[model samples]
Target chain A: MLSAHDVTRSFGGLTAVNHVSLEIGAREIVGLVGPNGSGKTTLLNLLSGFLAPTSGEIRFDGTAVSARRAWQPSRLGLRRTFQLPKLPARMSVLEVMLAGGRLPAGASPWRSLLTPGAVRREEAAFLDKAMGLLAEVDLAGLADHPAGGLSGGQQKLLGLAAALMDDPAVLLLDEPTAGVNPSLRRRMADHLRRIREGGTALVIVEHDMGFIGDLCDRCLALDKGAVIANCRPDELSGNQQVVEAYLGRRRPGVPLRVVAGGTAGAKSSGARA
Target chain B: MLEFCLHVLIMSAIFGIAAVSLNLQAGTSGLLNFGQIALFGIGAYAVAILTRAGLPWPAALLAGMAAAALGGFAIGRLGRDLAAEYWALATLAVAELVRLVALNEDWLTGGPQGIGGITGLFPGLDGPARALATLALAAALLLATALTARRLGETQFGRVLRLMRENPDLATALGHDIVACKVKVLAIGGAMAGLAGGLYTLYLAFIGPDQLLPFETFLIWTMVVLGGLGNVAGAVVGALLVTTLYAGIPFLKDIVALPSDLTGSLRVFAIGSIVLAALMLKPQGLVPERLRRLHAQRP
Candidate 1:
């Protein structure tokens, strides 16, 4: 469980995230949606400890975590994925997965040199774990490929796999389906459902309305860095302020609930297509 | 001629040690340590000071390594809040500060004249035999460091360091303590350079403020860039090549019939040209680093 109380972040005179409060309950999947500059990603950054808030407090489970640095939150079983998917270009997919595992005792320089045989065995176990996770994502076949050479969809899948390496309770995913293919996107939605079933909470920020609608239990809509409405994914378009925020103006006769394919409020059945 | 060639070979071995350490820091971990020579100088001065104070060689060497490790800790603390480029310039300043200490503190370093008559390993041997012994020792140490590098290249620690080199944020997202990684890397690298410094001082039987210059750091840089950025064997290859040319190029002055005054400048020009050519031909150096792989059989 994670909660934020009236968090605000600013850069110089610009208040990127004005005053937003959010709570992600255990095993709950929440979609954060807004226009291009409505501070969705910035809000995620603040919650995940990438950016300290100008004023407000963030708590994970029950501990005060506002001043903690980026890596600190993950140690508390809170993990995040980058919006643009920043996989190391030269590392193999499997190697990237291994990096997500707990930092081992063999990682120490002295320990690595003194007990190389033991270290080798430990690394073998880590390799096995990473390979298992790759298979879970249906990527065992491409584990040996250079991460940078993978397709965009494959890269996003790798990011997902790497984040899960920590086995965190709370996941903050920034656009996991941004550049993925339709098939992988569908698979990802299925996987996200399974993740929720396994009792892991997720705070996802995505522009793919259909994807968000499919995966999210509840959706939080934003307008000018503040919460505009909190509703079900299917009920998102029906909200009046959310419609005005997306269209930038209210229509005389049009309801603004455009829930067709690729339209603003595309409806997703929250099931495999 | 044989003596000069043997000495050059020995110096390259020492430089090989320094280059290997530099590769671990700058080439793999992406920490630009312009103070590498400062750490090296710290080790040399520590050993020099301790040996003069009646400490044994082995104890003196360990003390020197500890001294450089402390300096590395300082770099980590001071560099935590700074950007990468600024950290590099800060290291350069650290090197200058180190050299100034060695120059002004005549009680220890002997200033510009340098400390001399430092005893070497197997000091009873003749010039040729001593060269062989020193070379053997250097080779053994280099082999140990190389083996360690290879072993690390296969582990999670090495992967994180390599990842940090490319994109540190991704490394962080994976739950790696980036500053902790940097500090450990710098400390280990500084220790290696310190070891090299100890061997260098004993081999030359002299050290001074002149040896603490940033140009010395660049020589190790040239070796790593020439051989390869992320490969241990590449550092050895680059060190051998750079030191060979460095020792051999003076003969070029006589062959080309250049003025004696221009010899130093010509060597610089020649080395610069070689580096430029290498960059043009192979930007990643003679051996580009390969992706680190886990040895698990595909299932």
Candidate 2:
């Protein structure tokens, strides 16, 4: 559903994302994992049209979208979320989601003012869709509340819900679970899985290995702006380079402790407290 | 005394319209438009020119609104590419350019001589009929503007504008076309200023380039700041208070021993002091935007 060819981006003398190319078919959930200063977010930005690739062509659903403006890409079925949830402080959660829904094809000044009944009906439909999306994200109760009042995890959920409002064919999520508690992170991962099952492609950038392993169909690892490993989640755990990159070196003398009774459920309940 | 108070009230109504428009562009849209007076001047000139060419009052008034909207559209286009401070400077330049054009375009505007002998709102009416007509028109404009402000404030468009003000990056990420939204706001605000200008010309039956001066721009800005940024009702109250002070303070010369010239300077000084005090004590004005209300409501 989304493809990039020879995508490379540079800032001044620094190459942020160099010669990176990837593709994800429909209904596939792909996780992009890297250490700090890795080009995961930059690659996502380039794909989403927030940052123009210095030398690359991005094709979304077979149409080239590399040259399109950031604000126009969502209409072409490309949507993304920032690492930090960027909700407008003044807008209610429902209002923010409504903004995410594409503007009607015939929305012009004359139509807006002269056809009040039509506008009202369109608005009601958009509101209903947004409300349904909010319910899916478990944020229906906060629909009327200003989005800024939400906690960090709730704001992330709101952001994801907003992306879903457009029924995007491909979603580029940057660090969706960075600051969220494990339980909410799991819920977010589950939401991604459900979205993928519904035929939408997702490319998620995350640092949490457990969440990515559980949710992603395939994991792509990057180091120094280049892909180091592209493997299945289970294989990624056993890859020698991946293990060394993440943990320096595995020691035979020290046994790895597998903590018990520390599921995402416990974390979420603690967060509620 | 009653006649003077009524005149002051009428002038205040006109100012209220201008202030509300200014608040829409500056407060709600987060644009620093320093050329609101230019729109007013465009409105006044449009009305005067069209009326002189034999058009009816209503048509002339709407023509004036259209003229101001065109000027606003031009400024909005410029505002799209420019940042706030640059946009403010560009608007000021545009206002001055309009005034210069009005001054030099003697064949159309009659130069410094100004336009006069224009008909009143109700041409055949005398006394109460004229007063009632003017009051009714002003009240209607105020009511319409208030409704527009309220509706726009509650809209998805308004939320996007506010988002632009708070975080341009997030606004873009959320799919708001910032430049288009800003232009729309500027055009709407310019239209409001034009309406005020048409009303003012009808009341005074005169138009002059001096009316579009920087002082006039500052006065509207002061009204917006004093009333509260982004609060349409506050603009009304602020305009009424400022106009009352502008007209009422001159009456104090009748009771005081001060000379007219000294009292004029003293009034100017007083206004400056009040603005400074307002900036220091209540920079947000008496009625801040509803977003601030949300902040206060939070735990």
Candidate 3:
């Protein structure tokens, strides 16, 4: 489980994430939706240890992790995927997965040299584990291929696979369906479902409303870095304030351009418009 | 001619070690250590200083490596939270700082005249024989270094370095202590370079601040780039090829009418040209870095 208490982050004069709080239960797939710069990613960064909040406390499995290093949270079984997958360009697809797992014995330079046979033996086991992860993401064929050479969707899948290697308790995915095709996007939704069933909680920020609608048990909509609504995913459309936070002031007889077919954008304008 | 070739071989072997070290830092970890020569200098000076203090050769060499590792850890600390470009500049500043200290600390470092009467691998051998002996010792060291580097590359540490190189954030999100990883990488690389420096001082029988210039750093960079950035074997190949070009140029004195200074300058120019060509055309170098296969264990 993961929870943030009134998390607020600022940059110079601009407050990026302002007094936002939410909680994710075990095996819960919670959808996080917001307009551009609504502090969705920034909040995720705060929770995932990529950036420290100016004022807030985040707890993972009952431990305060607000000051933890970027790597610390992951070690605590909390992992996050980047908005733009920053996969190592030169590493093999399999190597990417192997890195997500625990550090093996004899990682020190001299020990590695002294017990190369042992290192190799462990590596042989890692190879099999990585192969299985790759197969889950339909990337087994590209295991030996350079990870950077993958398409955007495939890279997303690879990133997912890499995180899955950690067998994390919670995953903060920035945008799971951003560059994916229709079928792959559907597959991603199914994958998230399976992962949720496997007892892994997810906090996903996405513009693909249909995917969010299908995957999320509950949805948290953010506006100006604050939580505007928390309700069942299916009930999200009935929340007038949530719709207004995402779209412009509602006209008396106008059907708003909202959540259009789970696309990357939902033709919405904020209150300023 | 045979003696000249042998001399070139010995020089290449010394350079080969530094190339391999740089590859570990830069190629494997993406650390742009512009102050690598400083670590090299640390070793060279350590050997020169320790040997003058009546220490045995092996002890002196180990001291050199320890000094370099200490210096590297310090630099690595400074490099924490720095971007790659800033880190590179910081490393350059360090190299300059080391050179300045060596230059001003005349009583300690022997200033420009340098320390001499240094021990050799086989002091009694004739020119060719000594060269051959140095080559043999260098070969053994190179073998050990290559195997160690390869083994390091195969371990989880190496994987973390490779992953950390291009994607520090991603590696961090996957449970790597990014700053700590960088520090370890620098220390390991610095130790390897220190060993090379000690060997250089032993083979040349002299060392001065002149030998630890930024130019030496650039020369090593050229080799790593020319042979292939991430490949350990490429580093050796590049070092040998470039060292040969450098060593062979002086022999052109009798055949060509060029002045000695011009010939020396010409070698540098040629080296620059080759690096330029490599960057422009074969940026991956003669051998590019590639991830090792998982083998047929599961495939």
User: i-RMS, every candidate?
Assistant: 1.7, 4.6, 1.6
Q: Roughly what TM-score does model 3 have, to 2 decimal places?
A: 0.95
Tens-digit lDDT track of model 3 for B222-264: 9999999989999999999999998888778889888899998
lDDT rank order: 3, 1, 2
Instruction: State model 2's lDDT.
Output: 0.80
> What TM-score fits each model?
0.93, 0.87, 0.95
Best prediction by lDDT: 3
Native contacts present in candidate 1, fraction: 0.65
Clashing pairs in 2: none
Model 3: how far residue B12 lies from native, Å: 0.4
Fnat, one value per model: 0.65, 0.24, 0.72
**CAPRI-style grade of the A/B interface in model 2:** incorrect
**Deviating ranges (above 4 Å) for candidate 3:** A66-68, A251-273, B124-126, B295-299
Q: Which ten contiguous residues of candidate 2 chain B have the minimum total lDDT?
A: B290-299
- What are the Cα lDDT values of the candidates? 0.83, 0.80, 0.86
Query: Candidate 3 lDDT (Cα, whole model)?
Result: 0.86
Q: In model 1, which runs have C-alpha deviations exceeding 4 angstroms?
A: A66-68, A251-273, B295-299
Model 3: what is its DockQ? 0.67
| Winning model by TM-score | 3
| Shift of residue B54 alpha carbon in model 2, Å | 2.6
